[model samples]
Target: MKLIKGTLVALTCAAMLMGCESKKKETSSIDVKDAEVSKNLVLDLSVDKVKNTLGTLKEADSFPRNITKGQKDWNLVGVRDWCSGFWPGVLWYAYELSDDPEIKAGAEKFTAPLKEIAYTPADNHDVGFMVYCSYGNGYRLTGNEEYKTVMLAAADTLATLYNPKVGTILSWPVMVDKIGYNTIIDNMMNLELLFWAAKNGGDKSLYDIADSHAQKSMEHLVRPDYSIYHVALFDEKTGEFTKGITHQGYADESMWARGQGWGIYGFALSYRETGKEEYLDTSIKLADHFIERLPEDGVPYWDFDDPKIPNAPKDASAASLVACGMLELADQVKDNALKVKYTQAAKDLMAKLESKAYFSGDTNQALLLHSTGHLPHNSEIDVPIIYADYYFMEALVRLKKLEDKIAMQ
Candidate 1:
């Protein structure tokens, strides 16, 4: 029943791509707002920082992971790292913005090391994170057949982790707990690669796999209030849902801000691929939930439902991801009021990201600062993560397109 077939599905995808392409074209008649002008200034600064970072990394043989505060050096890691693709992805975004030859070359060079991981990913279900972000962006921006082939192989590898019975991709092969089938809300972001492959050149079963995972996540991981749990455990043999717990949140019951961000982006992307009304509705709910919990500056505490609220660490990555999803959701909705509400919210979030509180000053190598990776382990509590930078740049790219689209209208 999940199977969507033949020319109709293909044509629908084509129309969506065409609409996206049309929005990228610039228009001179549309007046740019003063707030947007300020946003543009921040984006330009970000691009320069990226260029300088890449320039410094040109001598390195590997990709950057993250930087500690007041550190001039970037920590290096192999392609096996979950965050490997983000640097290349950020480079690709820079090229899309400036079309600089050096930036394009850097993007390709950094992507070269990741090609092997597409075929030989570890048992974790993050090939989407490792391959899709790098080569996926490569294929989208450059139309390189090589990138497409690598990404399709990665999609196949990711599919192998899919538990049809459990209806979600396995996030980690081994966890501290002995659960045979473990899934996370972060897995939702991985489905975009599957949907892309299915619509473009891969099997329709890919779409079904992604859809099933989304359906299951909605059933078990999302709370009635729209906050998401970090992890959902299931019996591998029977697909019976067991328990919902938090591996990275403040507590088992707390609302992890980044988990909600993942849900928002994942569901908005699902709506985009399938035109499913339910997906859009759920995305809106998740976005609203996150927005309602934001502090006055719009950046969220690491966990929305945490006890140390006012003193909690800020997660700029969550804000960046939510902003990107909200912009996409704003475009897809038919209700003008909803569209405006989401659009302004996205702009506010972006503005907060550019502010002195969250924005790492010009001296830092990282673009956005104060991201929380794993709070429970006392690891990466407050730092600049590569994924945070990648999403922030991506949100800027999306905001520009939305601005151009609105101007034309």
Candidate 2:
């Protein structure tokens, strides 16, 4: 049965543990409903919504057809690390819910190779979330040495990008003698790699470097409103923030949908790493702004402020990322009212996405509908995105705590 193979796949990375040299803490207390009945009601509603969404994904055959792609069009599972990484996370959540060894195997099968991918010569900053969030979690769940090795190696590679002078990792690759390039908002996700290194690899310097880079981004990349500027120009040798430009958005200052999502979760992560109230405060401010500006359905338009992208559809991937971040923020924040708002907003948004946007016919392709890859870059607009699917499943599992995932359509 496909279910058997699916479960077996997760075994590849099962029984791994997170290696951390330090403990990260946030002092904020979440305002989870104190009344047992009220909390249960909210939890039940969220769980029901999550189950229905997972069901839709299963019915749709949501796993991408081609895991490794040649690039005629887009394949959700383009490569092992690029898109397929989500499978491990999905499997982990599935295993959590069902206690099925098959689900566990699936997560392992997909997560086992993360080290190789991250160490590849072409690796970039997103490697943290791209590799670690999937495989690292697998290692954490299963105590698997291979996945842990990979996670550590990936963290090391990510650290190599650090520019001590500039106090941030050089984001993308550039040609020899080229200059005028810097980090992107998406790179924020990479900090987790450094964090893992500090925790598990006995590398405190890595965390220090990560902290410095994050501070640089906050100083130059994040706007006053907490909206992000995608790409910035930096002095190559000096590594100082030169200027911020809108590389992925309409212009230099426009906030991209995905970029905003990246910032919310990324900054929240920074807060998690260090209990500094400022990061938490910044995260809340951005989350509030994002929630307030969301479209009626809770999914945001491509840009919260820009009007240039023509007929921009709601990005399912952005919504999914934002939801996960919101949930994380909800659990992290101390204020009762704020926690309720963030958690409820996340749930409400996912509920709508689960109901209206998910493709329900094939288990291999279950994803919330209407994702835009990139407009200017023309990557994938209004379609399925693997990261979106990953974060969506992450949100579901985080919310509902369901675990048994069989790859049955």
For model 1, the local distance difference test gives 0.82
Model 1: per-residue Cα lDDT at residue 299 = 85
The number of clashing residue pairs in each candidate reads 0, 61
TM-score of 2: 0.77
lDDT by residue for model 2 (132-228), tens: 7677778777788877777777777778878887888878766214546577888887887788779886478988988887788877888887777
User: Which regions of candidate 2 are displaced past 4 Å?
Assistant: 1-81, 175-179, 306-310, 359-364, 401-409
- Measured by lDDT, the strongest candidate is 1
TM-score of each: 0.89, 0.77
